[model samples]
Target: MFENLSERLEKSFKLLKGESKITELNIAETLKDIRRALLDADVNYKTAKTFTETVKQKAMGQNVLNAVKPGEMMVKLVHDELAVLMGGTSTDINLKGSPSIILIAGLQGSGKTTFTGKLANLLKTKRSKNPLLVAGDVYRPAAINQLQVLGEQIGTTVYTEEGCKDPVKLAKDGIAVAKKGAHDVVIIDTAGRLAIDEQMMEEISAVKKAVNPDEILFVVDSMTGQDAVNTAKEFNDRLDFDGVVLTKLDGDTRGGAALSIRSVVDKPIKFVGTGEKMEALDVFHPNRMADRILGMGDIVSLVERAQEQYDEEEARKLQKKIAKNQFNFDDFLKQIQQIKKMGNLKDLAAMIPGMGKMLKNIDFDDDAFKGIEAIIRSMTPAEREQPSIIDGSRKKRIAAGSGTTIQEVNRLIKQFDDTRKVMKMMTTGNKMGKMMGKMPIGKRR
Candidate 1:
């Protein structure tokens, strides 16, 4: 998302590459480059100026250790300053009160309704809270239907008053329904205008007054750039929102809204929408985001995603199968499915250290595994269990069933065989060493 900014910042740091320590004279050009990078990313000019100044001040004040290069020290200083610029720590939504109410506010087409559904899904699955989606967006035709569809997809309940034009009444009644039904959380999706208007603002303000919500979230489309930050300020001035939610962060955005909104509006970004899926919502962590923007990778977030898909019992079973060389196509397919559930493949890969830079120019499609999956699905149960059973005739049949070439099938079989061999060697620690020794002298450790 912040690809251009990351590259520019890297180049800026290179200005100090050969220097032994950070000095004011050498740091000026680097700061100018950093400020230019932020400005090019659509950041507010004043915010960018202040950010670079703060970073420069910090960099000049710190004593560089003998082990730390000047370039590395500058990168760390900028990373810390970036995090401070983007709300130093993550903020949690206030879910207090009986049947906690969360009011959603934003401009039209900001992905407000979509984020509402995602928040409900997160609450239901992660927090174990029974959340009721309140379709309070009375102006937009089919808005209730959209919320209902999202609720159905997420297995959550949607409360709607089909003909009700008064959002305040709808919000109040929605909370009442939630209380009666014992729903732990009520998320009210209010109406939004294409542009800020008096009528729209008043209606939402009246609803906020009526509901007295525990948390008010202002949803913003990060791709809107500085416009997003300006809109967030207007919303905060009117509704005094508790936090911000940046949507469509996975798009080709400059990331100005995420970096500048907090400084401008004095609000924390509670969550970020990474993809279109309901499961793509992530708690906004400024430090981790700073790391990602600097091409340092977000290993903590990567581990968290892994933990979300981890199952202790399943891991033990997989370990036993690997040890016995019984990890077949079925098991391999299951592993692929688990990885798919962890959000976008390219995004996941970017979470690894140094992988983001390697993948910067690569267009990684999430469906890259489609061919392998199709080939495996076309296999018979016996063939999947024992891949060795698939010979020349079976390969042709499987190729036809999967809409792939016989050569492609052969390639997949060879890849699977190689993977199994490597896995077997891993399981047998001594065997891995023996295999390495068999390689040419120069190639072997």
Candidate 2:
């Protein structure tokens, strides 16, 4: 996700290293490099030029503080400007009307259907809105079926006519169904062509005119880079979309669409599709994204994800169990489940400051926790409650049951024991602090 651009920008900032102040002379090379970095990331040439100019003007005008180095000051200026380029702040979708209508439009293969499902799931779970998914794609084969599957997976009713060829009528009837069902929102998934055509544009226009949707979201595949921005502009010209949805952002995207679409289309990026899962949709936040691009990480989003899966009652009970030294394999397994529910492992890791660059070379398997989960599941309930009861024979049996080796089981047990000891120390805060104080410097481990 803009890894190359981030590296280039970091290198550009290094141009100011050891400089006394941000003079135009010292900053010329850095600004050039920053502009080149943006261009390489497929940003609009004009936008890139304008951004660098704005950054330079601000850098030269501001008085640098003694505590802040030239390089550090430059980075701060670029970060804020990048945020402004991406829309300055997040924009919420309008849900003002009763059974608010949201029209989804895009070129074919833009993840329109998938994003529709994700949006429905987001509104249903987060906003407490009863959403009705409407399958408006009648031309494409199995488009309706695909939406139906997604609707079922998200536990939302999908409104589809068995053999309706008229998308405008389908959308209209879908909204009617929402009103009938007392649904708070109606998301109509419109059809798309491989390329934009007059017929396609006209058909979508008709639907828009008929429905008078509260929001029309133009979804685009972010991996397409500048093409995504161009497609968004074309769609906006016809439909005047309310927002943009950049899908497949978790892929190897250069991030041009996210950075350029807002400025080009004059619409805020309302959402981003980070992964394939229905729960992967995120409300686009300019500052957080700028932080990610600058390798600053997004700790606020990380905490928000954790809080979503957090349960106050369960947390209090877990704390008590840890304080009493009663945290067991079952509790450990439950903790793993909670983490897994938070979203993709690598995505979560990237939310931590500095972890993105550190883990960029590592490949995270979707089943990364499978072995540990299997091993824990293989244990008897009694053994899970009291792991000390497991002896040599029990280790062999559990390893065989989990399709693992005895050494693997032994390694897990060692790790678990260490984790329990550390957890106990953490619960006893002063004791843990004193232990840290007693440890020899540079030999703490």
Candidate 3:
């Protein structure tokens, strides 16, 4: 994400590579390159110029402290300015009211529906809120159904009325239903138009007036670049949305929308849609984003994702099984599934503090456990519980039945045994492991 812009900014900083102090001349050269990089990345030209001006003034005015080098100082100054430009701090979704109403607004194909589902899941799991997803997109039956499937996947109730043509009424009734069901959050997914049309604007505005929503999030496709900023402005002018949701940030987004939207509309970016999964939503932090733009990986977010996926109950249950020596193929497969659900393997692997640059070209399949899963599926219940029951002859038969070579099956068993040993160490001496440890297994393997 923003790789091109990251590369460009890194090059701009090189102008101060070996300088003891920043001068106006070197700062001018660096700011010129930075301005061009921003323009190339589809940032608003005027905003880019203003950004460089701020950066340059600060670089020239600041006393280059003895503790930091010129390059480090420039990076720090630019990072701070970028954070302020993108709204100095994160703004959380307002869920204060009983059955707090959240209205989703955006253009067609802006991923409004997907984002609604994701937001509902986030509220339910992360915030411990009982959320009711409301289908307010009456224009498309498919849109309602899509939301239904997402609600089903997340185990949330969806409120919808058949043939309800009025989105305002649907949203009102949806909130009523949420209140009746003791839900704490109500997320209404509103309709979107192909472009910023009058009808679309009026429809969403009516919903806003009727519901008196606590939060109205304008979802914009980051890939839309400048158009995203303009659309945000249009929506904010009409509904005065509380925050912005930038979707499709995982793709080759030109960074313009993110850089300009806040400065343009004066609304903090509440969250970003990094991927299509319900688990892909992240609260936007300006300082953290600035770090990512400067090629520093987001380790904080990476750790949070892991913590969310690691269930305490499941860990305790597995630990008991390990002590009893009852850990089996089925348990190992379940662990793999849990890890895959956390996120994309390649992206998650790149989040370790020092592993991003190293794993850039290494291809790690999330489905690397597919063969092992198949092999385990072929085994009988007894064999799964007791691998020793599958001797040499049994292994040959299992391999043939599972459509894998005997050697491949043997490798999986050996890997599983090794994994158990490592897990025992992790559970038994967790503190010792943290203090005297090597890298995570993912990195070493």
lDDT of each: 0.92, 0.92, 0.86
RMSD of 1: 3.1
Residues 380-420, model 3: lDDT tens digits: 88888888788898889889988999999899889888988
Query: Alpha-carbon error at 176 in model 2, in Å?
Result: 1.2
lDDT of 1 at 289: 99
For residues 1-445, write the lDDT of model 1, one tens digit per residue: 8989999999999999889888899999999999999999999999999998898888888988999999999998999999999999999999887999999988888999999999999999899999999998888867788999999999999999878898898999999999999999999998776446988888888998898999999999999999999888887888898999999998899999999999999999999999988889999999999999999899999899888889999998987898899999998999898888888988989888789989998998989899999999999999999999999999999999999999999999899989988887777888767877789998755
Q: Residue by residue across 1-445, what tens digits does model 2's lDDT show? A: 8888989999999998999888999999999999999999999999999999999999989999999999999999999999999999999999998989999999888999999999999999999999999999999857889999999999999998988999999999999888989999999998885335988889999999999999999899999999888878878888898999999999998988889988888899999998988888899999999999999999999999899889999999999999999999999999998888788999889989999999989999979899999999999999999999999999999999999999999999999999999988788998778878998899877
Give candidate 3's TM-score.
0.89
Task: Name every residue pair that clashes in candidate 1.
Answer: none
Which 10 consecutive positions of candidate 2 have the poorest summed lDDT? 191-200
TM-scores of the models, in the order given: 0.94, 0.95, 0.89
Error of 3 at 341 (Å): 2.3
lDDT for position 392 in model 2: 98
